[model samples]
Target: MRLNLQTDYALRTLMMLATHGGQLAVDDIADAYGISRHHLMKVAGRLAELGYVVARRGRGGGLSLARPAEEINVGSVVRDIETLDGFVECFDAGSNGCPVAGVCGLQGALSLAVGDFLARLDRYALTDLIPSRQLFAERLAPTSPSTSPP
Candidate 1:
């Protein structure tokens, strides 16, 4: 199952924050990932609302992870951030027009696949995904806003 652009951007934003481990502006994250600012702003806002990232507004203020990387589970993030529904045509009865919706094993199999995928994701955290804090720190540049923080 392909994750939506929002989910992808959310993950990218989280990973970038994890790497920098410092205050980063939304623009910095968008530029770092080469994603749209409008979309990233939504992702960052949702992340802050969800307590994944702490957002501050003032001088020298920006965004940073609310907790340590090791504490933030990747799977939980995906599950919480993603709109997990309609893996297949038969998954949603409202839009499902499949003739064999009830009997077809495809839906059940795909469900299992999605479950397995999520389960595996739950086993990993931001730290686990990074593998090396040193490498991340070295690669990620710290964000320095020229003007007062928004």
Candidate 2:
């Protein structure tokens, strides 16, 4: 069960936003993670559309979390970012071409596993993973005063 890079970038972007106190330019986020600005832009756009972030254009404009990190559920984020509809052929009733679509336990087991994975995520919010915004900033932000050398 691997998550696509899109989801990974989404998480990273959210984490970056949560730690930084102010609006962050898309280029800054791309540079921070050494990812493509073009790709990051797409991710940022989707996040903004989902209401996880708010984006502004022009000078002094960028991205910021729409709500507090504590209010954003990791499970909901995963659910929004990942496609979980077809864990196994049986899960997708419309196009399931498997011969034993209803007779096998494989689909059921996989479904349960996928459900449990998401269920566990429901127990935590983004803040749960990054409790100290300052600490996250200090370690990950290249422009952090603490990370700079004398």
Candidate 3:
């Protein structure tokens, strides 16, 4: 059950906001993860639309978690941001082309596996991902030229 890049970026953005506990510019998040600002922007937009994050535009504008970190369930976030329909061909009943779709036990097994995967994630929250906020912040902090390796 692999999450697409969009879902990956969405989770990363949420985790950063959860750790920062304050509004952060999209560019800052992108720079921290060495990801494309454009791609992050799209993910941020989707997150904002989903009511996970508050996006403010204009000067001093930034993104911030819409609710408390502990209230944001990891599974819920993934379900909201991820398109699981394409996980397996049979998962999408309308587009399923498998000849043995009805008789194949693999689809049912895969379904259970995906359910278990999400169930495990349901046990965690955004805050759980950042066990040490201080350490996370420190790691994400920009490095000065003096601290940069040759």
TM-score for each candidate, following the candidate numbering:
0.85, 0.89, 0.96
On residues 32-134, what C-alpha lDDT tens digit does candidate 2 reach at each position? 8889999999988999989999999999999999999989999999999888996666788999899987888898899889999999999998888887778
Model 1 steric clash pairs: none
Tens-digit per-residue lDDT, 1-150, candidate 1: 689887898888888888887889888787766679999888888999899999987777778999998899988898878877766778788999998888878988888898999999999988787787687765554456864358
Give each model's whole-structure lDDT: 0.84, 0.88, 0.93
Decide which is better by TM-score, 1 or 3.
3
Steric clash pairs (candidate 3): none
Better of 1 and 2 by lDDT: 2
**What is the clash count of model 2?**
0
Q: In model 2, state the lDDT of residue 32.
A: 85
Report the Cα lDDT for candidate 3: 0.93
Could you give candidate 3's per-residue lDDT for residues 1-150 as a string of tens digits? 468999999998999999999999999999999999999999999999999999999999999999999999999999998877678899998999999999979988988888998999999999999999999988888899999779
